[model samples]
Target: MHRLEQQFIDNQWVRSRGARYLPVMNPYREEVLAEVTAGAPQDVDDAVKTAQRALPAWRSLGGAKRATYLEGFAAALTRRREALVRLSSTNNGKVLAEAAIDLDDAIACYRYYADQARRLDERQGAAVSVEMANVEARCYHDPVGVVGLITPWNFPLVTSAWKLAPALAAGCTAVLKPSEVTPLPEQALAEIALEIGLPSGVLNLLNGDGEGIGAPLSRHAGIDKISFTGSNRVGEAVMAAAAERTVGVSLELGGKSPILVMEDADPEQAADWVMAGIYFNAGQICSATSRLLVHEAVADSLYSALEKRIDALVLGNPLAEQTDMGPLANARQRETVNGYLATAEQEGLRVVRDARHRQLPSRGYFVAPTLYRDVPLTSRLWKEEIFGPVLCGHSVANEQEAIALANDSDFGLAATVISGDGDRARRIGRELRAGSIWFNSEQLVLPETGWGGFKRSGIGRELGPWGLSSYLEVKHVIGPSHG
Candidate 1:
C-alpha cells in the first residue's frame, strides 16, 4: 500500500505534526489503497504563515513571470498525465475515462490561466475614461494575498486546478487542503510544484479531514482569502470564518440541478445526455442534473430509454476499460447515499429503477444507477443534493411548466435543455435560473466558462476570467489628466 505520511510545506515533504493517519481506500476492492497524514492545527498555522511570508515576492514577481511558472505547471502535468490519471481513478473511484477527463481539464485550466496571467500584465494599470476632463484614472488588479484552498473528494485534481491555477496566476500564494478521503491524486500537484521550482511556500499542500486541516486553515488569521468547493454546510462555516477577519472568500457549493427534456427531443439521444448528466462521475458532480423535468407527452418514451441506458452501464472496477460507472468515493459516501435510498423507500416514491434491478459487484461501495419517476415535489430526494447516481424526476405539461419546475430549486447551479429545435432549446434554456445552462448537448464544462450559481448554490464563481478575479483585489488610481 502507498504511504503518504508527509505534508508538503514550504516546498518540502515533511512528516505532519499530527499523529493521526487516515486510510485511503480503494472503493472497488474494499481495500486500503494508502495511508495519508492527517495534518494538525499547527500544520495549518505553519502552512498559512509560510504562504504569508512568500506572498510579497511571488506577487511582485509580475504577471508575465507568473505565467511562465503556470506554463511550467502545465508542462509537468502533461509529462505525468498517465500516472496521475491512474492515481485519480484508483483514489477517487471514478472510471479511467472520467479520471482522464479530470486530468485533461486540470491541464487545460493551468494553460488557460497561464494566458490569463500574461494578459494581467497588459491589463494592469490600464487607463479608465472619466467624465471630468481634469481627472484621469487607472485600475489595477492586485493579488488578494495568502489564500486557503479547500477541495472536495469527488473531482480530486480537477477541483484543485479550478482553485489553484487561478490563485497562483493571480499572484497569490496558497495552502491547499484536499479531502482526506481521496488525497493521493492531489499529492502529484505538490510534487509538480516543487519539480517546476515554484517558490518555497508559494504552494503548501496539507492532507487531512475538515476538522484537522480545513477548519484551521479557514480560520487562520494569516489567510487573506478562502476558496472552497464542497457542501453548503461547510461552505457556510467557511463563510463565517472569513467574516471574522473580513477577508475575501469564494465558495462553490452544492446543487440539485435539473434537466428539462422537451417533447420534441429524440428519446434515445435525450437518454444519452440524461445519463451523462446524472451518471457521469457516478453523479458526484455538484452541478449534476439529478432532478429531471420531462415533457408529459414524451415522459413514457424517455423513461423507457433511460431505464435501458441505466441497465447497460458497467459497474465494476474503475481501472477497467469497459467500466462505465465505479463505486462511490468511500463507504461514508455510499452510506450517505444509501440513507437517501432508504428514505425514498419509506416515502413510497415511485422507483422506476434502482440497485434492486441490477447485480452489483461482490465487493465494492457501489450504488446502482437509480431513477424515480413522478416523485413528489416536496420529497427530500427531489430537493436535496444526494450526490449519487439517483435521478428524481416527474412529467411537466409543457415548456412553461418544464421551465417553472427547473427553476423551482434551492440550488441553481446548472440545468440542461434538450429539444429537436435549437431555437426552442435556447429560448427555454434562457429561462432557467441556473449558472450553467446546456442546450441540446451533454454537460460540457470548459475552462473558459464561468461556474457557480445563484442563491444557496454558491457565493462566487470559478473558472474563466472570473476564477482569476476571485484571487484579485481591484484598485482605482486617479490623477491630473496630463500627469
Candidate 2:
C-alpha cells in the first residue's frame, strides 16, 4: 500500500493543516491501495501564497530557461514511464495499455510545450503601425500570475500535464488540485517535479475534493486564473466561485459526444471505432462517443459487428497484460451509471447489449459494456450524459438526419464521422458542432492540436498553443518610436 500523507507546497512535502486523510482505492480490487492527506482551505491559501511568491522569479527566468526545465522533465518522465503506468492502472483503474497511453501523452505534451516555450520570445511581441505618426504599437503575452488547476479523476496525470505543462511554459506558477480519488499518480508527478528541481513555489500540489481545495482555489484572490476539467455541474460551481474575484477561468466540461456511422462505411471498422470510443476506459472519458447515430440501412450490420467485438473483450484485473478493460474508478461512479441504466429501461429504450449478456466478474465496480438501440430523442438515455460503458444508438433515415441527431446534444466536445468517401466525410465533419471531429476514424487527441469543445462542452481549449494562451494575458504596449 502507498501512503502519500503530505502535500507539496513551497518545494517541500509538508503535512496538511487538517488532520483528516482520504483513502485512495483501486476500483478493480475494491480495496484501499493508498492514502493521501486531505487538504483544507488553509492549505489552498498557503499554496496560493507560495505560488504567488514564486511567480515573478519563475517568469523572469525567461521562456528559454523554462523550456530547458520542461525538456528535462519530459526526459524524467521517459525514465519513469513504466512506474507511472502501473501507478495509473492501480489508482485510476484503466487497463495497462490505456494507462501507458496516459504516461506517453503526458511525456509528449511536456515535450511539445517545451518547444513552444523556447519560441515564446519570438511569438510574443508583434510590431504594428499606428495611425498617429509619433506612436508605435506592439503586443506581448505575459504570464497569468498564480494559476489554480483542478484536474479530474479520469486520466489524472495526463490531464494534469495538459494544464500544468502549458501553465509552466507560459511562465505561470501553479497550485494543482488533482482528484482525491486518484491522487497517487499526481503525487508521483509532484515528486518528479521536485526531482527535476522546479524552483520553490513554482508548482504546488494540494490533494482534496472540491470543498477542500477546488472551491477554495477557484475563489482565492491570490489565484489569477482557474483551469478546471470535470463534470459540467462542478465546472459551473467553479465558474461561479471564480466570479467572486472575476478571475480568468478555463473549463473543459462534460460531453455527450456522438459517433456518426455512414451507410457506405465498412461495418467491421465502424463497429471497432464505436466500441473503442465508448468502452475504452470503461466509458469514463469526457469525450466518450456516448451517442451512436447511424444510417438506418447499415445499423443492423454494424450492431452485429459490435456484438462480436464486445464478446471478445477481456474484462479483468487491470494489472493483467490481456485485460482489455477495467472497473469504474469508484463505487459512486458505478452507482451513477447503474442509475442511468435503470432510467434507460424505464424510458422504454431497447437494450441491444447488457451486463447479463456477457460473462464477467461479480466484484468491483464493473459495469459490462451495454448498448441501447431505437432510443427516442426525448429519452434520458439519449439526452443525459450517462458516462458509463453504455452506448445509446439511434437509427437515422438519411445523412441529414444523422447529422441532426449528432448535433442535438447540449455538448459539442467531440464527434466522429465514418465514411468511405474522403470528401463526404470532410463535409460532414465540417458541419458537426464540436471542438474536435474525427473523419473516417476514431477519437485521437494529438499534442499539437487543440482539444476542448463548443457550447456547453467547455469555455476554452486545453491543448496546443491555444492551451498556452489560457495561462497568458496579452498586453499592448504603445509608446513614441524614433523609427
Candidate 3:
C-alpha cells in the first residue's frame, strides 16, 4: 500500500527520474508492502558527487563536532523507535521482542561511535634519549573518503547502523543500498537524517537491484571503500566487483555456527540456549547455531531436552504475542527449509521433532521447527545452509572429539560452549576457531567486542572502536628536520 518509489540522493527524496521502480514485499503477509525506485547509475553518481563535495568540510570538523552529529543521529533514531520496530517485524517477520532489539541495537551503535570519536587521540613518537638530535615521528588515522554499504534484509536497519555509524564517526561519507526485500527501514532512516541535521550527502540511501545499485556503487571510482553483509554467494560477487575497482571491502557473510555442550554441562540449560540460538528468528540468522555438538555422556539427556523444546514451539503468526517462532521470511525460504527437511529424511537422519508445514489462514508462509539426530557430516541438513528453524545433533565421545567436530565445518562465524566451570569454559573458548564464543550463554552480541568470522564466514570485524578502523586509513608522518 505504501509507495517508497523514491531514492534518497543528495539529502533529498528523488523519484525514479532515471528508471522504473519495483515492489518490496512483506514475507509474513505474503503481500506487497512498498515500492522502491530501482536507483540507477546516475543516482550513484549523484550521491558520490555530493559525498565528495561534503568530505572536506566533514573531515575538517573537530572530533567533538563529529561526535555531536553522531549524537544527533541517535536522538532522531530514538524518536521513531516504535515505528521502526513495527516496520521491522512486518517486513522481516521477526517477533516484536526481536524487532525492538533491532532498533535498540541501531541506537547503541550510534551512541558507541559517538563516545569513541569523542575520546579519539593521536600520538607523536617519543623523543629518543640517545644521540638523536631532532627527529619526529607521528601516526594518525584518517577517514577513507566515501563508503558503500550493502545490507541484507534479515537485520536491515541494525546492520546498516553498524556500518554507517562507524564510517561516519571516522569522518567518511556513505552510499547505502539496503536489500530490496526490506528497503523501508533505509527510507525511514533517510527521513531521520533530515531531522538529525546530518550534512547533505554524508549519508545517502539508494534502492535498486545488484547491477542497478550495488555493482555501480561498488565499482565507482570515487567510492573509497565497501562494506557488505549478506550470504556467501553474493559476498563472493561483491568481492569480485570491488576487486575490479581495486577498492577495499569489509564482508560479514554466512555462518554454520556450532554449539558444543561439555560433558559437565547441564542438559536442561544447554538445550534451552541451543534452541534459542538457531530458532529464535525462525533460524534465518547467519550466526544461527545449526549444529549441536554434545559430549557422549550428555548426548542422550541433551537430545531429550532439545526434543522437548522443539516439540513445544508454537507455529503461528509472528504478530501474535504467543507465537514462539514465525515463518522463514518468505516462500522461497520456506521451500528451501522444507527441501532440507525432506533431504534430511532421505539421508536417513532420525528426525525427532515434527517439521510439518503448519497450515493456518493460508495467507502467509509458516513451517515448524525441526530437529535431526544422528546426522552425519555428509547429510543434507548437516552441510547445507538451511537458514531456517533446523538444528542437527552430533554426539561426540569426549571434549577433544567435541572440539574436533566443531572445527570440522567449512564455516566458523560463531560458536557457543555451555559449561558449569569458568576455567573450562575459558579454555574451550580459546580453542574454538570462531569470531565469537559464548560461554554458558548464546547469541548475546555486546557493543564492546569485535564480531566477524574465520575461513569463509567473513572478512573484517564490526562493533567497538576497532570497528571504526575498518573505515579508516592510517598515515605515518616523519618531520621536524634539523637544519
Candidate 4:
C-alpha cells in the first residue's frame, strides 16, 4: 500500500498535525491504493505563514528570473511524464489516454506560464496614458502576495497547474490543497518542486478534505488571495471567507453547459462532437457540455448515432489499452451520478441509453454512459449538473430556438455548435451565453486562451494572460513629467 502520511511544507515532507487519515481509492479496482494525512487548521496556518515569509524574496527575484523555475518544473514534468500518466490513471480512474492528456496539459501550462513570466519583465513599469500634460504615470503589476489554491478531484494536476503555474509566474507564493479523494496524482507536483530545488515555502502541498485544509486556507489572514476550482456551494463558502478579510478570490465552479447541433450538420459528426464534449474525462469536466439542443430535423438521426457510439464504448480498467472509459473518480461520485439517474426515472424522462439498457463493469464505481431524449426543460436532469457520462437533450425547431434553449440554463461555462455552414455556426455560437464556444470543432482548450464563464459558472477567469493577472495587483505611480 502506498501510504503518504506527511505534508509538503517549507520544502520538507513533514508529518501532519492532524490525526485523521483518509483512504485514497483506486476507483477502477474499488480498492484502497493509499492512505493520506488529512491536514488540520494548524497546518493551514503553518503553510500560509511559510508562504508569507517566502513571498518577498520570491517576488523580488523578478518575473524573468522566476520564469526559469517554471521552465524547470515543465522539464521535470516531461521527465516523469509516463509515470505520472499511469499514477493519474490509477488514482483518477480515467483511461490511460485521458490521463496522458491531463499530464500534457499540465506540462504545457507550466511552459506557457514560463513564457508569460518572461514577458512580465518587459511589461514592468509600463507607461499609462493620462489626461494631464504635467503628469507621467506608470503602472506596475505586483504579486498578489501569498495565495491559497484549492483544486478538485476530477482533473488532478491539470487544474492545480492552471492555478499554481500562473500564480508562481506572477511571482506569488502559494499553499495548495488537493482533494482528499484523488490526492495521489498531485503529490507529484510537490515532488517536482523539491526536485527542482524551488525555494523553501514557495509552494506548499496540503492533502485534506474541504473542512480540514480548504476552509482554513481560504480564511487565513496571511493569504492575500484564494483561487479555487470546485463545486458552487464550496466556491460560495470560499468567497464568503475571503469577504471576511476583503481578500481577493478567483473561483472556477460548476457547469451544465449545452451543445447545439444545427439542422445542416452531419449526424455522425455531430454525435462525435457531442460525445467528446460530455464523455471526455468521464464527464467530470467543469466545462462539460451535458445538455444537447439538436435541430428537430436531425434529432432522430443524431440520437441514433450517439446511442450506437455509447454502446460501442469500452468500459474497463483505466490502465488497459483498449478501455475507452473508466469508473467514476470515487464511490461518492458514483453515488451522486446514480442519484441523478434515479431522479430521471422519477421524472419519466425518455432514456435512450442507461444502466437498464447497457451493461457496466461487475465491480468498481462504474456508471453506464447515459443518454436521455425528449427531456423536459423543467426536469432536474436537464437543469442540474449530473457530472457523469450522462447526456440530456431535446429537439429545437430552428437556430433561434436552439440558441435560446442553450442560453436558458443558469450556467454559461461552455457550449458547442455544429453546422454545415461555417458562418451560420459562428453566428449561433456568438449568441450562446458561455465563456467558451466551439463551432464545428472538438473541445480543444489551449493555455493561451482564457477559461472561465459568465453567470454562476464562475467568477473571474483562469488560463492565458487573464490567469496571470489574477495573481497580480495593479499599482500606478504618478509624478511630474520630466519634459
- Candidate 3 achieves a global lDDT of 0.82
What digit string (tens of lDDT, one per residue) describes model 1 on residues 1-483? 778778899999888898888899988888998888787999998888889889999999998899988899889989999998888888889999999999999889999999999999999989998899899999999999999999999988889999999999999999999998889888888988888899999999999888889999989989999999999999999999999999988989999899999999999999999999999999999989999999898999999999888888899999999999999999998999999999999999998897667888998899999999999999999989999999998899888888888888888999999999999999988888989999889888899999989888998899999999999999999999888
Q: Report the error of model 4 at residue 112, Å.
A: 0.5
| TM-score between candidate 3 and the true structure | 0.95
Using TM-score, rank the candidates from best to worst: 4, 1, 2, 3
Question: Per-residue lDDT tens digits of candidate 4, residues 1-483?
Answer: 877888899999988888888899999889999998878999998888899899999999988889999999889989999999999999999999999988899999999999999999899899999998889999999999999999998888889999999999999999999999889888988998988889999999998877788888988899899999999999999999999999999988999999998899999999999999999988888888899999999999999999899989999999999999999999988899999999999999998897656777888799889999989999998999889999999989988888888999888999989999999988888888899999899898899999999899989999999999999999998999895
TM-score between candidate 1 and the true structure:
0.98
Consecutive 10-residue window with the lowest summed lDDT within model 3? 121-130
Residue lDDT tens for model 2, 37-66:
777899999999999889889999888899
- Compute each candidate's TM-score over C-alphas: 0.98, 0.98, 0.95, 0.99
lDDT of 3 by residue, 202-281 (tens): 88888887868887887888998999998898899889888888888999988899998888999999888998898988
Native-structure RMSD, model 3: 2.0
In candidate 4, which residue ranges exceed 4 Å CA deviation?
A: none
Candidate 3 or 4, higher TM-score?
4
Total clashing pairs for each candidate: 0, 0, 0, 0
RMSD of each: 1.0, 1.2, 2.0, 1.0
Error of 2 at 140 (Å): 1.2
Q: Which stretches of candidate 2 lie over 4 Å from their true place?
A: none
